[model samples]
Target: MYQSDITQFLNQLKQQKPTLEAEQRRGRSLLWDKQPVDLDERAKQQASRVEQTPYVYYQNF
Candidate 1:
């Protein structure tokens, strides 16, 4: 069997810390994993948004 340096190091690291993978999953869930979006709520927000003028410096008299 052949193993790259990174693979071997990772295997050793996992063996040293058995709970490392679980900790990684927990951290990832905290930041990357998210709940499902509400499409209806999003649509309502979009509908309520005010349109911006093309030129902000000039004021309409």
Candidate 2:
């Protein structure tokens, strides 16, 4: 949860806060710095999964 990081940030705020750009980069790094989703792969995953029953268990072997 970045508790320590938040504490450090608050402590720094008490003394000297960082610049707006620096804060923006830090916050963005925490949440928005992820790989983009691939539409094709997502579609493949959604379409590829199907449920099928191949065997009947009611009769004796």
Candidate 3:
């Protein structure tokens, strides 16, 4: 079988630290994992947003 340098390094790393994968999963969940979004809440927020004027710096007299 053929393995790239990165693959070999990863395999050796996993062997050295058996819990590395579990730790990675836990870290990923902390940052990347999220709960399901509430469509109703999102729609309400979108509907309540005010539209911005084309000329923000100029004051309308």
Candidate 4:
């Protein structure tokens, strides 16, 4: 009985915790092992879209 209870708890946890269920790749799962986006490439892409000058870059912490 106790073992069954533990198994039920673990099953509940598996349903709740993201890192477990995220392995299936069904929906937009959280990026567990994701690479950092290239800031330079992103900036170049944005710069190509907009034709403006004197832009101020502010760092938000």
Candidate 5:
């Protein structure tokens, strides 16, 4: 029981504070920005309606 307690204590300590380099390599990036989904939807709408006899940008606009 005493040996098991010591092992558990060591494991808990290791988990509390991980090193900085490991955190940086696979961590959440602070610089990431995503483009809006609406722009893609507008592009697809434009493409499909391109062949229509009357261009209808306002209907979908």
Candidate 6:
């Protein structure tokens, strides 16, 4: 049996821990591991909007 360059690379890769999945987890934790900020509960009160569309629609002949 003979190992090609790619095979050797893969064999070395097989020994590694904190692999791609672990690295992703660590990165996410580093960036996103924090208490979530609370959102404002107050509703945006606005004055009643005037109608912009035609109040009466007639079919075109």
The CA lDDT of each predicted structure is 0.95, 0.79, 0.96, 0.72, 0.67, 0.67
Colliding residue pairs in candidate 1: none
Candidate 2 clashing pairs, residues 3+ apart or interchain: none
Off by over 4 Å in 1: 56-61
Q: Per-residue alpha-carbon lDDT of model 3 for 11-32, expressed as tens digits? A: 9999999999999999999999
Better of 1 and 6 by TM-score: 1
Positional deviation of residue 49's Cα in model 6 after best superposition, in angstroms: 38
CA-RMSD of model 3? 2.4
lDDT by residue (1-61, candidate 4, tens digit) is 3568889998898879858665567344454646789999999898889554555464332
> Model 4 clash pairs?
none
Q: Which segments of model 4 are wrong by more than 4 Å?
A: 1-33, 50-61
In candidate 3, clashing pairs total: 0
lDDT of 5 by residue, 1-61 (tens): 3568889877776688666546665464544544557988888898888455475666665
Q: Which candidate is the best by TM-score?
A: 1
Q: What is the TM-score of each candidate against the true structure?
A: 0.69, 0.34, 0.65, 0.32, 0.25, 0.28
> Residue 25 of candidate 3: its Cα lDDT?
99
lDDT string for model 2 (1-61, tens) is 4569889888778567547668889999999898889999999998998855566565455
User: If both were scored by TM-score, which would come out higher, candidate 1 or candidate 5?
Assistant: 1
Candidate 3: give the clashing pairs: none
Worst 10 residues of 5 by lDDT: 25-34
Off by over 4 Å in 5: 1-3, 20-61
Q: Which ten residues in a row have the lowest lDDT in candidate 3?
A: 52-61
